[model samples]
Target chain A: MADAVSTPQEIETELRKVLSYLTGNADLIHADANKPFKELGIDSMMAIEIMAALEKELKIQLQERDLAKFTSIKETVETLLTYVR
Target chain B: MQALKLNKHEILKHVPHRPPFLFIDRVVDLRPGKSIQALFYLDPAADYFQGHFPNHHVMPGSLMLEALAQATCVLFDITYPSKRKRRFYAGSVKARFLKVVQPGCELELNSKVISMVSKGGVYDVWASINGMDVLRGEMGCMCVYE
Candidate 1:
């Protein structure tokens, strides 16, 4: 099981990987994961776009239950990792 | 070199439909593993759209749901000959509408079979623009072969 996002370092690493795939800006992978999506300035629409990309790439369908009723990279990633296993 | 392309002409053999009545244009790609990409060119004059939303002219959610079923039916058609083609009906759908689909939106509907029992299956179908999802849901149906 993926260890819970217990450390800022672990959270950042996963966030950076997800952001790179979602933004289509492969270069964005270098951003600090601790830098909140808000700090990086990701809007809800962009987050949804990224979620869609993640849905396709991961081959894991994110359902209504999977959305977590919140919008943000970290929250979404946590939700995804929770359901993925 | 394309492995799967179900054109309008071939669609007739697989579906009991005709011009004006047929809502789907083509099944562009299919991975026998139960994944499909389909196309539908909307016409404002389509009978269903006429009354679905008097002024807004949106594609009915029910029809969008039908497209998902039809896509799944075609998958069965491709895998099973007419002799064994079964009857399938909607069991349940956890659907969500994210955007308004206009009269001219060339929608691409894609789905993948997620789970199956001996007589039924579940499909994850999403409505999209090019590859951008517009509406999404999972449809459960009973695959009953007569």
Candidate 2:
């Protein structure tokens, strides 16, 4: 099993890898955690890529509908905590 | 039943997607309710190539998923020929694009059904060009009559 991410900070650290891979620019993902992914220039397709990476790397199966609900890194981290924590 | 082969024209009978939008080219092998293998020759003259990336010309990952989903539709129809009347739409997709597909490439697509409910089903799919993994993951969808 993957290491449990008990805190929001840990989730952010892990998610950075996914974002970096999706956008193909590690520097561009340095925005505030509270900033929405759309605001970070993540389109619908990129969002799906992130979701798939999360499921594959973290083994968390997030419902497709719930992806839109967690628009920001903070929101996503919190939701992911419920599964991995 | 054993795997069956289908040519391009026969592919049209199983899927409704037409030219420009249709991503699959030929069915190499298929075992209804189990798995499928198909081919798609990515034409360099495709319109999307001009816009997706004029210089780099990378095939969009979303379209790759669509190709996989379309192959699953073929599998669904072959599995239950009577249900060919149903229209299937891509509901969920979870895939990873491991390689960049350029124009003039011949993609070999493979799909396997993981589960199926009343009107919904799940499939694990993958694609390759010359024996290299390009994309792979799971897809799900529900069907309705047109």
Candidate 3:
């Protein structure tokens, strides 16, 4: 479970791992984290998948409205932090 | 939260699928917007078995996935009765075939809504024969309003 002590960098690393695995882009961790997922070739379906994966990994629950926050790596980490914190 | 059960005939009303293409035979349990449990009988004489294999017939894995998807559609229709007219399309699926399903096997299909999205939702689906796991996976479904 992701606790309050979890840092932004840790969350970012996990998010990058998920993005790289889902998008098959190995350079995701080193690329611009602020790039929009659409620009990174992530579609609506993939967005849904990322949310599902994160919820399972972090042992947290995210609502439908949070789907939009998955636009970029940084945004996703922030959204996840709100729950963990 | 009472368990809703639907027979073969009643199942048709909730989904647009018909014979041949229809994979679900009956819905054993359903919780609108939450989860669903259905069944399908793999008839040995089914057309697909003829070409799928002549000597040894095995239920196509894709059809099993389709059955799970159809079950999700039924759950969706019941959850939102007003959207019954809409079409349910499965956008993405990640599945693992654990066992070989042969003809005459009674497929027990189960799916649970993982989360609701803008267009549809994500679901965790699995199937078993005689309590033995055959397939397990997650899929995304979109309710396309026509």
Candidate 4:
């Protein structure tokens, strides 16, 4: 297993920055770190926008079935950490 | 309340876009990894129209590119955020036009995922109206982050 993360807080910190960036780059939607995209209202197109921005901004390769797990903010952040380290 | 109707307002819930830039007005359906049908109305008063063809208006190819990008972005927003967020964007896009997207013409964009990679994905998209292929292209995108 990967190094155990101390808490979900570490994951949220990374997510907050990513989500904030998503809100800026994507012209289709608005969201904060605390706000889950599903709650803030995100569909496939919007999801695709944020995903593109995140890929550009984060510099990570998350393609194919990798997308299946990162369907939500919490899951995305967790997944991001997986490839990052 | 017709069963097969979606307005811009409803679309907003799924996409992260505001006015002037957002292209796809509504999505008729999203069948997971298969295809997507989106609606857009050709407006003579659109911001880009003034410059694209002062005398004869035509939707520029760049806007179509952005539309594809925007629509795909919105798709990821609803389908996979936290994971794909770190992995979504167009690496390549090629389009061909058989006819013009004139004012008042209702446009429909139909796209299907062709292949997915470790870094990005490719989609085969066809833009049509009245069951005619007006524009067609293959879009390739990726997610690069750390």
lDDT of each: 0.65, 0.79, 0.87, 0.63
By TM-score, the candidates rank as: 3, 2, 1, 4
Candidate 1 lDDT over residue span B1-146, tens digit each: 34588887887777655676666789889766477888998878788787888877988777777877777766656655556656666656778987778787788888787753334456787888767787899775655566
lDDT of 4 by residue, B1-146 (tens): 22233578877765556788889888886655456678888788897888888898888877776677666655545544444235445656778878877777877877776644344456777788888988888776655555
True contacts kept of 3: 0.57
Better of 1 and 4 by TM-score: 1
Q: In candidate 2, which residue ranges exceed 4 Å CA deviation?
A: A1-85
Model 1 regions more than 4 Å off: A1-85, B17-21
Q: Second chain of candidate 3: TM-score?
A: 0.95
Worst 10 residues of 4 chain B by lDDT: B79-88
Q: Candidate 4: RMSD over Cα atoms?
A: 12.9
The ten-residue window of minimal lDDT in model 2 chain B covers B113-122
lDDT of 1 at B94: 70
Error of 1 at B10 (Å): 1.1
lDDT of 2 by residue, B82-139 (tens): 6446777776677888988998989999998665433546678999999899998988
* Candidate 3 chain A weakest ten by summed lDDT: A1-10
DockQ for every model comes to: 0.02, 0.05, 0.57, 0.06
Off by over 4 Å in 3: A1-5, B80-85
- Model 3 Cα RMSD, 1 decimal: 2.2
* Cα lDDT tens digits for candidate 3, B10-102: 998888999989999899999987999999999999999998899889899999999999999888888877643577788888899999999
Model 2 scores a TM of 0.62
